[model samples]
Target: MEKIKLLLTQYQEAILYIVFGGLTMLVNIIAFWLAFQAWHMNSSVSYLFAWFWSIFFAYLTNRTWVFHSTAHDLKTVINEIFQFLVARIATAVIGFVIFYFGVNLLKQDAQIWNIIQNIFVIISNFALSKLVIFKKKA
Candidate 1:
């Protein structure tokens, strides 16, 4: 129990991030599924809708819980948000390219491709947040 507690203490942020990441993925997947399957939207359009909503959800959770950002001032908060959005946009572009190749060009399953893309996005986002966006102030 002590060892388990130590482990949790050491990696609490990561564990929390993973939990929230799963929720973010759920949001993304559900939005995509609803847009594409239920509403019969174009795949690209559906992906955009999912991306927008997921980014919003991810930003809220990541800023508040995952990274515990303390930027309370208007300028700092704006800067933090801008940086986060930039990183997310970069990942989104990568995801879009991967999805295009996997689903449109190679004729793979959208669901499967989306899952794979999200795995990459989650890892990249974590690294970006930890290293760049929400790094601890020295």
Candidate 2:
């Protein structure tokens, strides 16, 4: 128990972030698949829907647990959400570009492209959250 506690104390933020990020990815992929395959939605539209859901989930988890944001007041909460959205939007553009090139231009499979895009987004998002969106205020 003591060893586990010590390990968690040492790497709580990272471990939680990874676990939540993975959940977010799962949400995105499942949503995308449902919209694209089951619902027969347009590819880009499905991707957008998945993006919206995943971002919302990510924000909730990140604010509540991963970064432990202390946005008590309305202004601070709005600012933090704005920052988080901006960072996510930046990554969204990257993902979209990759999807566009891989699917439309190269005629690659959507599933394969989505997997690749998520891999990049996950890595980039962790950096963005740590360095910019969720950086502890000095």
How does each model score on TM-score? Answer: 0.76, 0.72
The C-alpha lDDT values of all candidates are 0.91, 0.89
Q: Which segments of model 2 are wrong by more than 4 Å?
A: 92-120
Q: How many clashing pairs in candidate 2? A: 0
Show the lowest summed lDDT stretch of 10 residues, model 2: 126-135
lDDT of 1 by residue, 56-109 (tens): 898889999988998899998889889989998899789889988999999999
Residue pairs with clashing backbones, model 2:
none
Worst 10 residues of 1 by lDDT: 116-125
User: Model 1 segments beyond 4 Å from truth?
Assistant: 38-40, 94-120
What value does the lDDT take at residue 58 in candidate 2?
Answer: 93
How many clashing residue pairs appear in each of the predictions shown?
0, 0
Question: Which candidate number maximizes TM-score?
Answer: 1
